[model samples]
Target: MAGEVGKPNGSGGLGFKGSQIPHIKFTKLFINGEFVDAVRGRTFETIDPRTGEVIAMIAEGDKEDVDLAVKAAREAFDHGRWPRMSGYERSRILMKFADLIDENIEELAALDTVDAGKLFSWGKTVDIPHGAALLRYYAGAADKIHGEVLKMSGEYQGITLLEPIGVVGAIIPWNFPTNILFMKLAPALAAGCTIIIKPAEQTPLSALFYANLAKQAGIPDGVVNVITGYGPTAGAAICSHMDIDSVSFTGSTEVGRLVMQAAAASNLKTVSLELGGKSPIIIFNDADVDKAAELALLGVVHNKGEICVASSRVFVQEGIYEELEKKLVEKAKAWTVGDPFDPTTNHGPQVDKKQFEKILSYIEHGKVEGATLLTGGKPVGTKGYYIQPTIFADVKDDMTIARDEIFGPVMALMKFKTVEEAIQRANSTRYGLAAGIVTKDLNIANTVSRSIRAGIIWINCYFAFDSDCPYGGYKGSGFGRDLGLDALHKYLQVKSVVTPIYNSPWL
Candidate 1:
């Protein structure tokens, strides 16, 4: 590994001051440990959602680039040292990768803030650190891949081996790019699979930077590759590529369906998708109104409400509905929306103009559907794609805001009377990514937790994530898991070897 680069000596914040800013590096397609231009020399501008300014002209990868990346990844899986090395050896390399990420955490965080319009402090504190920790966690699990020994009944011995599924194509969404990328990459690496990652064009800078860091961490050439492009061309190629063994995608349900279709049409590769969600946060009558209101606000407002599991639908029991709504409005007003670089800013602009326009349209739909707008229904400023945190009350289950996966800072508030009604309303959406319940009664909490069809159930907290905990979804939210030991299985295939005890069989 190369010597560590010196950390930038600034205010350690992303705020613009005195002409100091983090440098941008690694903008090209990363393949076989080399950064190169696209074959056709096509480039697309990555815009900063904060000011609607062009951040950088990133190399645009297409089907050709995807083919090249997949070929490289296939070669790496077939003949390279990465897949052939022992699990402990891979563990050391992955651990070094995690350490390097820690060393350059500030730079990576800044890149994500600029590219994804994420809060700078959150990028620095939560995204980068948590990503590094997840890498280490998967690194620790590298040598722990085990298979069961089955005892045959007819004097036969069977030994199962869990082997790498070969090349993996991981397509990650723009929201939470760093965290989501690592969530896919770490487990695949731990499972000894070579990967070709396609980061969303909206936020490709951080993934490219991580590719450079992986090289510095002594990861072999072609073991890890990153291709930055639009979903239609580069992404479709990955899904349909015959050489790729698995496709793990994290994005909208619409795109996930297309990916599944492509995979089935081409190679029938294994697909693990963590798709869209309109998750519900149920506030019971027995819950603490203040705490419930705070969590409900955070549930929909965090990351400018771009998370896959954002509890956008809030179900409050009629008994405490008015009080919780008032408290949520107060909390919403307190959330500062400003420059992402500013450390004091809790909210940032939307990722791009398209998302911004879509959110505004949903707000309009809420009004057209007769949902009462309690607070925040307009864009924050004229320059950037910033929408004020929006909340709608009296939202019917059939309303557009409540039914659709509006990936924005929009909250749909619905009133429910009984526990049975709350459970039904919570499970009403096709999305079952996550749900939250706030109540003092253990029976209510336990009942709702078991009744909800979502993958993750939070009792009193929102967005509480652990690296070891399995996370996925049910129904339209997609299938398979992302974090924890379960994610490793996505990149592995089980093989069974059998031998006759007396060597008297067909052999």
Candidate 2:
């Protein structure tokens, strides 16, 4: 399937026959609303994980490039129309941006598929459309930002205003590049803040294209900037920059810690992180075994298990453990692993070679640690970075595969006896990103949902996300929230105004 290339179908869509790929248009760094070369003139190749070939050569941005982007963002925030504009005005422009995204949905979806190795069908049907919807959601939220009048004790009146936090540095991950980018971008824009974004080098094409779309949508120059480069260079610069008022990051917890340290050492800028997870999905004996098994497969195998909130750790009650395990294994074996461009393909390759090797290593470790590999513990084909949808049974809480965030097509199944035991085992890991509960008994669902330490809880459903829902993490998974009104606040700060009544200040 990797050998199949895409050809021009001449119907405004690229066709993938065999070994053909689409050409990428946006590969340069975007600063002050213009696409330009890196100051150092250095470039890096973005690989097509499906074929292990170079898709495009992207400009490599370092501290120098970040400085330029940050300077532009600072100037835009301090002396530009964006932060000072009325919410209604901003909302109109954002609505245009969302419309532009919808207009170019096919190109964006194809870019995500070729660059990130996600299934093309899911990219078109789920990721791209969801991003556009989130943009519209935030657009509606723009005009609703408000301040409140408060009663005061003495002879004074008080009011609190929600102001833009100034320049925001958004560093997004590669797993769901477009989705995560808008998850941060929409709110920041709606809050009337200027931003400098650093996209992961692995999947920088869509972000660059979006930057262009922002310009076409009438976003003013310097309001939105995108720098494409490696994390340690461009990402570190954004984190430690003294001028950036806040930094919102979504990636691994290890990197999230470094971002926090950088923020503290620089200017104590506000930092919001949505980091890694080893989430759990609990299935009680009362759950519909067939449905539970299907959702369990979807939870871990979606996006090839690269999701930050992938429910990698699944706990089934002892009464139905064997039954669920068998069902899950059968579903895993049935999942088709082939060309991402094929609409029927259920799964695609890992994002890159490093991630591919890492997942295989974890599978080996699980085997060595005495867990039973029920199915799919090997690579799929001779070409590409594809791996089988792997599942392990009898996994203990202390096992490496169970404790760590695999971030790949891997699932660890463990058995639990009671609700108390399930909660304990679920919360034992440092991550508290998300959890799922599947049970017909409302009491069991409610009790487990309350006791489990996770940010998002899914009842009998997996990957149920919405634009209005607030999502974030606790513990090692990091802090702050994304989506909903709560996310809007992440890009805003409060200011209080007070005045003494005329001649009534004890004069």
Candidate 3:
């Protein structure tokens, strides 16, 4: 990394002031490898979540801008050099993109920290590097994409060839903006597909910054485009666009439905959705009390509880329920909530005012529905959208907080008497995105993990994501995987060719 920026961990509670932060440089629609204004010359304010103030004026792209982006992407896919170029050549460009990310990690990290209110250290340590590594991971797969050969019964030969699926439209979520962008973009690029990204309106800074980096890395014109606007306009446009071959979306389950419906209502384009979750962390009596509490609390508190797969519904075994609650209070106290740029701050504010209010309302619902407020359930400060890490005890399965996807750091701690009861309660919700089990017993681990109908399960750990691990959801959480080789395959289409032998009867 060239720029050694960002403050180190210390005892200071204060952070870099708004004036001290890096200036917002890129805030326009990125299409055809150029920074251009929206078609109508309209713009919207991208707010700084930490202060609930406008950070910069970003281009507000609607249907017309999406159309322009799609047109550029279509031309790139049908006639441009990106799709026609050799996989190795494409891989070179992607590798260079990753390299440039490393070179300007400071500016990129600052952009996400200010735009999305993500912890700056987390951006530097995890978000930026992981996203870059995702690029490299997909880069390694670029040249290796291939098909299979088949033998026919009667003097014939058959072979299947894998090819790019053409233009892809990706709708990204506000949380984890950088990571999700690369998660969608890396695989699409590796598969030789031109992509039009509709980043969540709240956090367009990093995506726009990434677009500039993509162009600098020598990614061909029109191969990667970003439209920064709201879902109803830009996102819906991408989903319903006739020319788009496929759409990959990550957000709430309700929005995922809209994306699917639009795709079906339009050209029936392929849609892959990684949607919301009310994931559970089941704690067995055999587990370490502190470790289980840490896992459960961190799972909810990380990213200010803005993540989809937050283990918000925790089912603790009756034997260790009280002890784990005490431990959770201790750990959450130390998990300070403050400005993103503060190195001492482990958690930051919600993505925007809307999300912060939504989380607070859910916390109130937990109380109204008779769930015990174990600890930390109020706003941290007056100015920013910060909420305390709250844990609700004696939470019923039927409670509003337990039932709904409260995408915040509010844990619904419920007690279960038996292993069968634990499994049954954990699988009760409509979401099946992810689940975590903290147990030393091997039999219990195997039994409950296999029984729960979730896409991914963690044993004694949470948020254990890697570039190689396939992450997605089942049931109402929506279908399709994000990372791993499966993501790469989603952007590719398979075609089989058959031929008869010269002296065969078939000819």
Cα lDDT tens digits, model 1, 1-507, are 111222221112234331234565566888887887888888898888888877777889999999888888989999999988889999999999999999887778888888888987888789999989988999899998889888888878899999999999999999999999999999999999999999999998888888888988989989999999999999999999999999999999999999999999998999999999999999989889999998999999999999999989999999999999999999998889988888888899999999999999999999999999999989987898888888999899999999999999999998999999999888988899999999999999999999999999999998989998999999999999989899988989999999878854642
* Clashing pairs for predicted structure model 3, backbone only: none
- Please give the range of 10 consecutive residues that has the lowest summed lDDT in model 1: 1-10
Sorting all predicted structures by lDDT, with the top scorer first, yields: 2, 1, 3
Model 1 bad stretches (over 4 Å): 1-21, 503-507
The window of 10 residues in a row where model 2 has the poorest summed lDDT is 1-10
Misplaced by over 4 Å in model 3 are 1-19, 502-507
Q: What is the C-alpha RMSD, rounded to one decimal, of candidate 2?
A: 4.4
Candidate 2 lDDT over residue span 388-502, tens digit each: 9999998888999999999998999999898999988898999999999999999998998999888999999988899999999989999999998899999999999998886
The models' CA-based lDDT, in order, is 0.89, 0.90, 0.89
Best by lDDT: 2
Which runs of model 2 end up more than 4 angstroms from their true locations?
1-19, 503-507
> Candidate 2, clashing residue pairs?
3-19, 4-18, 4-19, 5-18, 5-19, 5-20, 6-16, 6-20
